[model samples]
Target: MGIISMIIIGLIAGAIARLLVPGKENFGWIGTILLGIVGGYVGGTLGSMVFAPHKFTVQPPVNHAFLGAIVGAVILLVIYKFVRARV
Candidate 1:
């Protein structure tokens, strides 16, 4: 996917993730976008490992990527909360 596509997907995925995970996130639009982008990479990597261990590809399908992005974002958000609480 192109940079713009990634950004758009990231925005959507981030927004959806924020909605699913209930809590107060201080970050705004840019932070959300970055979270989603990172989540996409994290999710895509893990998804490939689980789903297609043998056939590892750099880019997963759009649907899978979207789902993975949300899951990844949620995981990150949870981790963030935990770290914040400890600090």
Candidate 2:
């Protein structure tokens, strides 16, 4: 997928992730969107590392991409909360 496609997917994935996780975040919608984009990158990278050899990539089908994004977002959210709590 292209940058634009990734952004769109990230937006949706980010929104879904935000809804899935219950808690007050430090950022707003734009932050969520950016988080999603970063999540997409992180997820894609990790997924590639874990599943690339097995060829279980999340590129072709949209579902995998969405799933990956959610996973990534959740991870980021957790980290964010952890760090925020420390500050």
Candidate 3:
């Protein structure tokens, strides 16, 4: 999928993840959407590079993409927290 498609997928995945993960305040619509878009891109890039032998397609498997999106969001959130703590 292209960046646009990935962003869409990520947005959906991220929102779902945020809803499901629980425990803290949600990122709101705009932040959640942005996180998802970025998560999709990061997840796709990392997954493809690490799993190069699979001939990773731009159109990633939905499960993998979803997993990637969630992971990316978690990573982003963690980093955000870390940076915020230092500020």
Q: Which candidate is the best by lDDT?
A: 1
Flag regions of model 3 displaced more than 4 Å: 1-8, 16-26, 53-62
In order, the Cα lDDT scores of the candidates are 0.85, 0.80, 0.73
lDDT of 1 by residue, 1-87 (tens): 899998998888888888888888888999899889998888888898888655546655456778999888888888888999899
Question: In model 2, which residue pairs have backbone atoms overlapping below 3 Å?
Answer: none
The true-structure Cα RMSD of candidate 2 reads 3.1
Model 2 Cα lDDT, one tens digit per residue, 1-86: 88888778888878887888788876777787898988877787789888855465555655666788888987888888889889
Model 2's TM-score against the true structure: 0.78
lDDT of 1: 0.85
Task: Supply candidate 2's per-residue lDDT for 14.
Answer: 84
TM, every model: 0.85, 0.78, 0.67
TM-score top scorer? 1
- lDDT, candidate 3, equals 0.73
lDDT of 1 at 73: 83
| Per-residue lDDT of 62 in model 3 | 61
lDDT of residue 49 for candidate 1: 81
**Candidate number that wins on TM-score, 2 or 3:** 2
Cα RMSD to the true fold for all candidates: 3.9, 3.1, 3.8
